[model samples]
Target: MLWYVLVAIVAILVGVVIGFFIARRYMMNYLKQNPPINEQMLRTMMMQMGQKPSQKKINQMMAQMNKQMK
Candidate 1:
């Protein structure tokens, strides 16, 4: 009986760890394929805020955002 209980606990822990990694990897891939935001979206947001987003400025902001993500 003690052996069974121990085995069950070990299985549960291993499952939890594996599930966590699988979910994390799935989300990372999903986000990479469909990023939370993009250049066009950023440009629109800036324009809505009454800021004229030049291409250079947009590139800079995008680079900064990517840097922060890393």
Candidate 2:
């Protein structure tokens, strides 16, 4: 009976680890295929805020955003 209980606990732990990895991979892939933001969206947002966004500034912002994600 003790052996059976130990095996059940081990199985449950392994399953949880595997599930975590699988879910993480899925989300990473999804994010890569569909990023949370794009240059056009960023430009629109800056315009709405009454700021004239230059290409260099936009690129800098994008770099900062990507760095934050990592």
Candidate 3:
């Protein structure tokens, strides 16, 4: 009975490790295949780098970026 329980525990642990690796691999591949970007995402990232961006400044920057993009 003790041996059976140990084997079950080991199996469960191995399964958990495999699942974690599979999920991480899938996520990494998916992200590499599809790199996402948008103005809002860039703004959020910039805000996180320092202070929160004001709406006025954000709007101004958005306009500038739009002009540049065009």
Best by TM-score: 1
lDDT of 1 by residue, 1-70 (tens): 9999999999999999999999999998887788788999999999999999999999999898878766
TM agreement with the true structure for every prediction: 0.91, 0.87, 0.53
Model 3, 1-64: lDDT tens digits are 9999999999999999999999999987776566454568767977889968777777787677
Task: Report the poorest 10 consecutive residues by lDDT, candidate 2.
Answer: 61-70
RMSD for all candidates, in order, please. Answer: 1.0, 1.2, 10.1
Better of 1 and 3 by TM-score: 1
Residue 11 lDDT in candidate 3: 100
* Per-residue alpha-carbon lDDT of candidate 2 for residues 7-68, written as tens digits (9 for 90 to 100): 99999999999999999999988887888999999999999999999999999999998888
Clashing pairs in 3: none
Query: lDDT, candidate 2, residue 2?
Result: 100
TM-score, cand. 1 vs. native: 0.91
lDDT of all predictions, in order shown? Answer: 0.93, 0.94, 0.77
